[model samples]
Target: MDPILLGAIFITPIAAIIIIGLIWYQKWNYTFKDLQHIKGPTPLPIVGNMSELGDPTKIFWQLFNWQIQYGNIVKGCYGMDMLLLISEPEYLEFICTSQSTLPKGIFYRYLHKWLSFGLLTSKGKKWHQRRKMITPAYHFKILEQFVEVFEKNGNILVEKLRGEVGNPSFDVNIYLTLCALDSINETAMGTSVDAQNNSNTDYIRAIKEMNRIVVDRTIQPHKHFDFLYQFTNDYKIEQKCLKILHSYTLSIIESRRQELLNNPSRFDSKYVDEFGMKKRIAFLDLLLQSTIDGKPLSNEDIREEVDTFMFEGHDTVSTCMSFWMYLISKHPEVEAKLLAEQREIFGDDPKRPTTYLDLQKMHYMEMTVKETLRLYPSVPFMMRDTLEDFTFRDLSVKKGTQILMLPFYLHRRADLYPEPEKFIPERFTAENMSKRHPFAYLAFSAGYRNCIGQKFAMIELKSTLSKVLRSFNICSAVPEHNLVIKSEIILAAGNGYKIQLKNRTW
Candidate 1:
């Protein structure tokens, strides 16, 4: 036998064997078995049900339809990836409440890179530690201290809107985003970013870019390949955005440190009334003062928490406000009712902004906000990865499988919410709430990892809505406009929310 011929024969079989092993590994790692009994639309290879997700406008509706067809608990695959969609309240309770078994999925790893093990993305022991450290910042008493911040920012928002009332309708999303940014910065960071006045600040710009990039990554399948993302334009944008965000945060941290170092007496008892009383003891301050196991947090830890709060605090609340404003604009009856409630609560005091006490008294307003969140949660979907092989009911779910919970579908389930499409706030009344499952309304999510800023968000929403309603009457400029929702990091309207605002007679 020739030497060349023998070498070729040996190489060919080795190459063939390698190829076969690669194929088997791909199938073993990515593909799911026994999903036939679980029920869902047939998934295409590699892409899975991702093809159905391309159109943002129809994605949520289509997912809901799938839930209807496949029942409350549906199992599907996304490109060789196994995913379980749980819309049932009982199952959701199990998943959310069971902290030890399921952790945030791989999708959250992208967020973890930016947020760095903050409460939102951290899991198990790390999450437990961070959650405890941060819990004090969101205490009811601490939240009470921030009421003035909400009202002041809310008033500023109203003034800004009042200026726009005479002009043709403008996109309310921008204004809502600004109001949220301003509110969160003042209340959470104890500083004013003036987002409404200086909307193009480096921090604000970076945040918008970060949001855009994250959403883009979630939608683009090719970006999932680590090497591809590293070389892609999207990745470049993400890197630049992260740099801008971190730089801005570091500057703030350094400034605070210098201010404290230069005036150590600022912490003294005599200076308590002069400096301490007047000083802003905001969320960031609390985090700065917090310690664990006899050691204070490092700059890196503080940065992570601050950045996490900055992103989560503003975006979710803004998204909620955007949806709530659009809904109010579309439904004149609801708006009118809200206005009437505001008038009744304020009683001819148009200049007086709603206080925390006054806002708490606005039961109807709270219900409306709750209803809006139910209909259009900022986070439409949440993903969890199974830590171990688990069984729910009769189905066996394997480890590493992604569990997707669509709040968009859960909130609209006919079984859970009757007349699901209708904007009925009465359903949230104490009486009606008692009749419904607690997990059915998950706008801020549920269980231990539920939104820590829920109360703060509600306070901001109420104050802004009340003040705005007092000053101006909002109506949709294009009442028949079929506003499509863009499923990004936040649920934004595709074409923006254009609404007409008329200054009130009062």
Candidate 2:
């Protein structure tokens, strides 16, 4: 054979393998390449814009920088795939409200190891079914029943703070986290972790450790694959934490089921109605009996969902409350308004715990919470997988592309919110809210996939704030500009919110 023909034959097969691998790897990028005209920070060939991903803070900082440079809809890349950061409300409304775009994206996978295919992680038919099944758990009456639990926890939190009233400024994140944890335990599981009193409990420790590890996993692209994650020290620690968490929850679930079974009368008609036989108040009770299209959930399936609720219900609320407290501390005028509202609702007795109805009467305090959420949304952003090609104004989004909706940026839009950086509770009022685009303020997100626990969260916020303000006034040691925030799945302060508490004399 000729030398040239032999060389061509050998090179052709090797070239074919290389070409095949590249096509397979860059399939998503190629599919969305039509969007190349959309301006963003230039991405490298294979790794894309995943550089500096090891630091969670810098990862988000890059996104923010790109948003500033490129505009609301900034195009970026994740590995070999295309990503679009959508912040404008006009586009937000289209993506969030659409059922086709409801499926979660890559970052959510970091949570799935611990949470499994739960409501937050699941998609397609399974997600739709679980959503319907779980919807009733947050019913008005059910949540109203949870208010007493909220009030009880709020009282416990106030009592806890009473000791720290005159002490140096302390980070209240852990304190508030424990209170929220206790409330969720009692309300969601009908069990007491006693998080406030038993702060060193294994369950509490496990949850904290697990969250930290998850944050570590999310930022590092190399750790995203299961095989790579398994070799790390964090993975071993995560496994131990998961074991403690799962065991504790399983033990609690078993205990609760046995309690109901052993004593028939204890199963109140309010909780377990005759026809369908569903529980009333506790979220776990509903989960225990819940069926999707006449099929009941398995033990593993139930665990996934219960675990997800446990994580979301407590952690996010604590973060929100911490920031809420910090914001009130900085703005004494806002604090006075909040106190005035609390006084009007509670009257002569400042010690009275807020009822669900009391929460309803706390219109001003509610607005303050809304404004706080806008300033520091609990979940800064959400990821969605686009189901099909779509256009928002002039911009075109391709199918299978991941959409990063930055509620943090959207909430801070100067056009949408005047003096956007300022803490303005009045902005959430009916008149002011009516003027803004409905999707512009997405503290709890919006539309079909909005946070189901939003109302439950508000009740907890109002209940806790009412009690805290009634007992003590907030004073921040950390200056407004000095408080540094970083996005680690949820919005978190680098150094926790440090605020001194003064005993309120009503």
How many residue pairs collide in each prediction? 3, 1
Candidate 2 wrongly placed segments (more than 4 Å): 1-29, 269-280, 478-481
Estimate the TM-score of every prediction: 0.91, 0.92
Model 1, 1-506: lDDT tens digits are 99999999999998887776566446534435655467788765446678886554666667778888888888776554677888888888888887544478777777765788877888888788888888877777677767788788877788788778876668887888898888888776667889999988887877877777766666668876788899988788788888887777767776665666788555332355533374446676666667888787877788888888888888788777777887888888988888788778888787875566888888999999999988888888888888887666765677777888889889998888999999999999999999998999888888877888788778778877778777887778776776677677777778877788998886
Please report the TM-score between candidate 1 and the true structure: 0.91
Worst 10 contiguous positions by lDDT, candidate 2: 264-273
Residue by residue across 456-486, what tens digits does model 2's lDDT show? 9998888888888888879977565466889
List ranges where model 1 is wrong by over 4 Å: 1-35, 54-62, 261-277
Which residue pairs clash within candidate 1?
A: 46-79, 47-79, 48-79
lDDT of model number 1? 0.78
Question: Top model by lDDT, which number?
Answer: 2
